[model samples]
Target: MGIKEQIYNRSPLFLQHLFTTLYGYQLHRERYGPVYQERFRMLLEREHTTIDVKAEQLDRLNDFLHFCTEHSPYYRQLFASHGIRLPLTDLSELKHIPVLSKEILRTHMENIQTDIAAPIIGKTGGTTGTSLQVRYTIPDMQIRMAHLDYFKATHGVYRGMRRISFTAQDLVPERQQVDVYWRMNRAANQLLFTVKRLSPRTMAAYLEAIERFQPETIDGLPSAMIELARFAKREGIRLTCQPIAIFPTAERIDAEERQVIEEVFHGPVFDQYASSEGAPIVSECRFGQKHLHHEMGIIELDTDGEILVTSFDTHGTPLIRYRVGDRMTLSQRICSCGHPGPIIESIDGRGRAFIQKPDGQKIFEAQLASLVKHLPNSIERIQYVQMTTDSVSIYYVPDAERFSQSDERLLMERLYRLFGRDIHLDVQAVSYIDAEESGKILLVKSSLTG
Candidate 1:
């Protein structure tokens, strides 16, 4: 546990609420107080009928059009260079503008930022490793959180509710600190279970902490939840305490994984399609129907099948027609859930899957990932790719003086234990790994079909 755990966790309930109120005030207040919460309530009560949602989105889209050209350096120069007029009248007019790729964002980061306030820079710890960084205004960050909170509330989660998150935070920075794996975010009533120290050795402590906290809701990556499930099953342990819901985010969840998760926890898993770059794309309803948040932006599927997003919600960085690198199969049929939005039939998110052997043997990606948990703290990125049925490649980028040949050999030895002795492995320490042009990471690439 950390110092915040010692200080905040020991505080009384009313005192904790006082801290939460103060922090919420500081975080949400921009031009005035109460607008954030008021907006949250408005969003909560309003039933987003498709037509109303579209009209509202278009209004925000129009406002953003004029706002971006005036305030954003990149969009301003791009429009000026192309001789495109300010304040487009119709959505059809936007067709002339090219889609904003991740390459553009990475190259012209400062240019895309709105000159409103000092921005908070955040890094995305995705499957590609911690390569993608984004900037958000403080108000925009608060709004995003509120937006997520409201969505969670739709399915019965609320503020100050007991929740536990299993995410990719460096909680126990030192590997030797075995006793400390989770810390209490007392103000928010959240228990954070870090992913780095989540192997079988630390599984017991994690379960104990989960039981101790007795969370009302479970949130975070599905990969981590599945990790907990696997650990519990292997050790002949079961989670007696059940949460109201399992909220999965920041990663993809397949049918098999989702089914196993539902069985393990005996709770409904509500999945959401979101990004760190201020795009709240789609969400799953209580009836397991996925609906597009039309109020969020104008989401379109291009000819190349890339999901292009124009987020009105992004004030810090107005991403107009940004090519967010996700491919999805969309549905047009009206949902049985009575939600008035188009369904996201499927999403191919940037998540790694398990590799399967020819003779019916399969390896869980999370299990392999736990092996790499012992890697040095200086390691910035890690990726393991399957080239052939018998061949594997490990690609990693390390901070200077952080990784060595000994580390590579050690990882290979660990892989050999899982894979047979005849398995071919190539481990390389590179300066950087390549991503899709739109900056999406493909964690695992296999030549052989599953």
Candidate 2:
């Protein structure tokens, strides 16, 4: 066996991946740093090249799927059971393969592979239930990182620039070793904020952190960022540190939330979609096109309103036609930026999160955010649960003071006007509302069928 293979197999799967990261750090310093800068320069050039040429991306999908079918035991068994095989020349042929769900991963957890040689590992956090751990190889992880760089460069965010990452990280007991990553990222000139402590007081602290740090970019789940924006606006506090760009991840960036963020930051907002199971897959450009990161994998938009993704970056526990619980659509036209890649008009969160109407006036959970402006009281956080087409339960987590009887009546009246009196409004109080494990707040949760 080759020396590289020997060393890789000897190391623990997770540790081998860590060493790979160390190697990536060197690669970043010696090669990627310069190359990526040039790539960024080209990306922002007057005449930009198409990121992944259509012909080449088509070819890569065949190789990627075939690799998964061969190396990933879980996918191999799934394909065999479902009468599926890989190596299709055309991307359109992916339809023959059924979409795999998070439930399948949870059930067949052991069948997922761990590449001891060229070792790798990963985790699918907060999707179906608890976060399920997955593994990946060195090549897989590097490809994913490269794709991130490609997307960041495409949107004018580079490595050296200061970035404030507002994500979930615990302070006491030091939850994960990865918490160090956030700090290391900060020391490397990026500031990181923990949404684990995102209260009104904590948000004010976040504002102070931004002012002191002066981050060039802010990246996090859109919900937390929007809440901060709303807090800033209402409290008459303006953060002097207006980042050049704000990249919202982990959740759907609805129009109402977008408007508020843009107003607060006084800049354009870029949205990207990623999941615990999938690599950072798609990014929206300034022209508002949600272009798939073709280099990482082929992301398919099935007519069933599901996103089926197979990544070139998941060699450890490779996913083939993996259903990532989101309902997204491909854009019908080329972007105004002249990029040939597909545009994502919006992400409608998860299936369980969508609200269906018999009258066909389907509503998304995020539509509840619009009611905030319409509410009499300064609504801090609200969770709406649609039990049926005609019934929904509204749970309001009011601000500092308790909701008065008159305030409750007015809020109820407005909600009735919107969803009708048929919907049951159940008012409840909580210390604070939180997003799901993926760090996404469900503005509306439907008790009905997912």
RMSD of 2: 14.3
How many residue pairs of model 1 clash at the backbone? 0
| Local accuracy by lDDT, each model | 0.68, 0.61
Q: Using Cα atoms with residue i matched to residue i, what is each candidate's TM-score against the true structure?
A: 0.76, 0.65
| Residue runs of model 1 more than 4 Å from their true location after superposition | 1-33, 48-51, 125-130, 354-441, 445-450
Query: Native-vs-model 2 lDDT?
Result: 0.61
In terms of lDDT, model 1 sits at 0.68
The weakest ten consecutive residues by lDDT in model 2 span 171-180
